[model samples]
Target: MRARFIFSALATTLIGTAPALAQDDLSVDQVLGAWQKQKQIFHEAQSSGLGQTRGLKLIAVEGVDAAETAPQQGVSVTASTDAPTSTDTTPMDPNKPLVAATATTTTTTAPLVFGQLDPELQVNLQIKFGFDSAALADDQKPRLDKICQAMKLSDVQLFRIVGHTDTAGTDTYNERLSVLRAKEVARYLVEDCNITASRLETLGLGERFPLNQDDPRADENRRVEFQALS
Candidate 1:
């Protein structure tokens, strides 16, 4: 009887903890593979030359190895008129010639600018969990307020809010929660801080970006980042 009771307790423990262990066992290689795939898709879309129809062109689609020849190289034009019975062949008074001539040429090069993320506006805002109206603790409010004030002072034309979550729950639930948290923060910024509705965009990354992968359930990994478009 004693052996049976011990065996039953061991089985219960393993069954209860299996899901929790699985949740925290994501591999770094898997994360990196996903990131590389996303990068490849982005580059392929950029190099496909379809952006020109939308007024966005890749400045360096033709790589540096592809040389361009000058459009006007070796190009020439000439004009002549029949001489008047060999009488008008007397140099035409140097500058009083009866024929006028002109030539025009043009060349173009791609602009030097390239597509890149802005450097100054990639700030991270922490939306720490709390039960009251405030998302963060009272001690952290001053720091958050400073960030809000700085954003207000800048010529920020657009805002992007991206949310992330620790790898705790199912992917679907985490994704939904992340989006909701991002929207909640955006609403606070728009209503309480006077940020305009048209200037806001929201995204949720779920558990895809863990600050500490060894501990996927760490609260610090759950965050929302803010980006400003000038």
Candidate 2:
């Protein structure tokens, strides 16, 4: 009880110091704990025909918050320093053919609409921009800087920054805006936060995945998410 109390106090302090993102219950240490994603990539050997066209066979990828829903293949994480360790859960089946496997390395179980997205690690801040434009306000930069600190502190080296928007404009316009917004946040991380360009990736959802399904045009939907990648 004493240790838990001290940790909670520290968390409160950290949240208090964070930029506008204080609205969301995110802390730098929590980010570190819940960031690393694990995946079991299977590399199939080449055959006589074009069966091995797809070089890398992605067997299973566990997202940040997939511990409960996802299979036991993921590295389970908690909002504490004592992070859970992951081991090779999937044992090879004897029936499968022997292949020289060079072990080379999703909100939805299906996969993020266009590619990959994780809403669990996303900071639900409205990252306010100039009306209808992608121009970010000066005040919001610090909040993003806090995010940069969290990303740098995380165990995963690669990070994905996906942009989202409120469903208030046309589909095309929203899409473009989302892209620009995502790029802007990425730019801040790279330029201001000193994060490497190659380590980060950007994507735009454009109001497709609403945080508040009841109100698609809610301010919470207009946010930027940073997800850790393995």
Candidate 3:
């Protein structure tokens, strides 16, 4: 009966200690694998992808050891220095003035001439449209002649003749009229002033962009603008 009692006590102790011994004997690789799984769960939870809620539940179960072991799985890890990398991205400056200091350089810097005009010529003409007879009175012919002469003297390259009209007429009628007026002016320049046909371009903007919106029918509304192009 005493021998039977001793055997019973030994059996109880073995049963209680078996699970603890098994846990202690777990291999390092197995421990690392468990850690990796926990890390994967934590990472999956942190990421924006699907199954995030399930991953969060797993992370709660496994804890941060799994996360700590994850980065060591694929490769050997190294400590990183805390210094930021410097980059030289700025362009070199030549230190020269943008606008050179010479009259020839300024004049040859491509004339502000568009089509066949210098914008400065608009000041003397008092008419924005270069060839709109309706905008400029018959008395202004001499002034136009003088302006054309000045353009010729300056060796201008190209002249652009743009025609505009007031909103007094229908869109279709005004468009045609504006185009015809611009063409007529271009013809006069070619025939009367001896300006080359190749040097001129005519455009008609019929009541499109009004200079004065308050009075679309104003005299200034019906005009032509000249642009000189080099």
lDDT of each: 0.40, 0.47, 0.37
RMSD of 3: 41.5
Q: Give the root-mean-square deviation of each candidate in angstroms.
A: 29.5, 19.9, 41.5
Model 1 misplaced stretches (Cα beyond 4 Å): 1-122, 130-143
Pairs of residues clashing in candidate 2: none
TM-score of 2: 0.56
Please provide, for model 2 over 86-175, each residue's C-alpha lDDT reduced to its tens digit, 9 standing for 90 to 100.
432233232322111111122333322122223343344568877665555678887765577876776565565667898999976786
lDDT of 2 at 210: 67
Question: lDDT ranking from best to worst?
Answer: 2, 1, 3
By TM-score rank, best first, the candidates go 2, 1, 3
| Model 3: lDDT of residue 108 | 21
Among these predictions, the greatest TM-score belongs to: 2
Error of model 3, residue 226, in angstroms: 0.4
